[model samples]
Target: MHPMLNIAIRAVRRAGNLIVKNYEIVSTVKINQPNIKNITNSVKIELEKLIIDVIRKSYPEHNIITEMHGKIIGSNKDIKWTIDPLDCISNFLKCLPNFSISITLTMKNRTEIAVIYAPILNEIFSAVRGQGAQLNGYRLRCSNAVDLKGTILAIGYLLSLQQDNQKYITKINQIFKHNYIDFRRTGSVGLDMAYVAAGRVDGYFYIGLKPWNFSAGELLVRESGGLITDFNGNHTNSNNIIAANPHVLKSILLKIRNI
Candidate 1:
């Protein structure tokens, strides 16, 4: 195992223990309670601190980027860690068991290692740059669906509605019109992409996501024999992202290209 990957696993597992404890407490409360927001927010902040502490202890010279902390620069500029301490906060607050902790390490602007831990599910999806992705300790592979027929897709929503909402919806509808079995709107990008890597879902796509939303999942998909591209099937643009095995991805791109 890579030393950095080991540290990341340690950090998320420690944070996951805290999250699970709080998850049980939140489960006892009604989602409508005012304090529910406060509790979950507190956990998120605390988890961020805990994860950063663990990383800083191991590599004091590496930079860090996080949703809560923005960016914490260290001596090393080429190596940086991107973290989403708590992904899918809405699901966590609602006790939906779909949230995750996402951590990615990049060197020279290329992802070197990625880890996404779903504490509620006790599953860890991880990948090293050249190595294949793994769920727990087992290898992962994307579904080999040759085309869209009978394939189940995972769709993620943007954090906010974009100006081209109508066009996005039109594309989704047209894609659905193809012979897919059904589509799921999971609202959790980390887990959705992890599912794609593990073949739980055939493919995943979302628009207007930031780097932290897909960095870890991006590495996982690629290591699992999948492809990531924009609506027009260009790898250069990731603002509007699509991920799937080669066959499904090509088919999806064709469906949405002219829309």
Candidate 2:
């Protein structure tokens, strides 16, 4: 592992441990549906404090662009750390292990290293753009399934709208038919992308995501020998990502684009 990635690995692991301790001790959780995002915001802030402190103490002048509390950062230097403290709030509140702590270090918007730790399951997924992706230190390789049949893909949404959302409903219909495989909604976008990187899933697509939502994991999939693009099949931002192994990419794109 690279030196910087080593730091991210340690930090995410420590943060994950802390969150797990709190998760187990909390008897009940407040589930704010309309404000479900705030749950992530709050947890992210708390964890950000710990990470910023560690980073600042170890190496000064490293700016922090946090999703919760905004930025307590200055001009960019050689490094900018992006973080998503908690990836899946709903799952966490429901005592599910899908929630994750995501950390990434980038230089000029290009990811260098990333670490995502899912505490309940004790799974640590990490990736460096050039080095490779890993699960518990074991290397990852993209799935070679050229066809979508039995691919076991994953997809999900942020909030549930009315069934009248014909566009979305139509999408679900098309994706299901095109994928032709069992699918899941784990509620954690980071996990979705990581699964693609680790070949646990053939592909993952989501709309209305933020940079913090998929940037780190985007690098993970790409580094692990996968591809990522917008739903329209353009080389767009990770905000609306469609990632899968190269073998299935063309077919996946054709199937998805039709919807």
lDDT of 2: 0.78
- Candidates' lDDT values, in order? 0.90, 0.78
Per-model TM against the reference:
0.95, 0.89
**Residue 180's C-alpha lDDT in candidate 1?**
48
Worst 10 residues of 2 by lDDT: 160-169
Off by over 4 Å in 2: 27-42, 74-76, 160-165
Clashing residue pairs, backbone N/CA/C < 3 A, model 2 = none
Question: Residue-pair clashes per candidate, as listed?
Answer: 0, 0
- Model 2: per-residue Cα lDDT over 1-259, one tens digit each: 6877777877787788778876875437555677656655666678888777766666677877776667767554768888788877767777877888888888887888888888888898898878889999999988889888888878866564444245555765775784568778899988988999888889887767777678888888988999988767788764556789876777767765766
How well does candidate 1 score on lDDT at residue 169?
A: 87
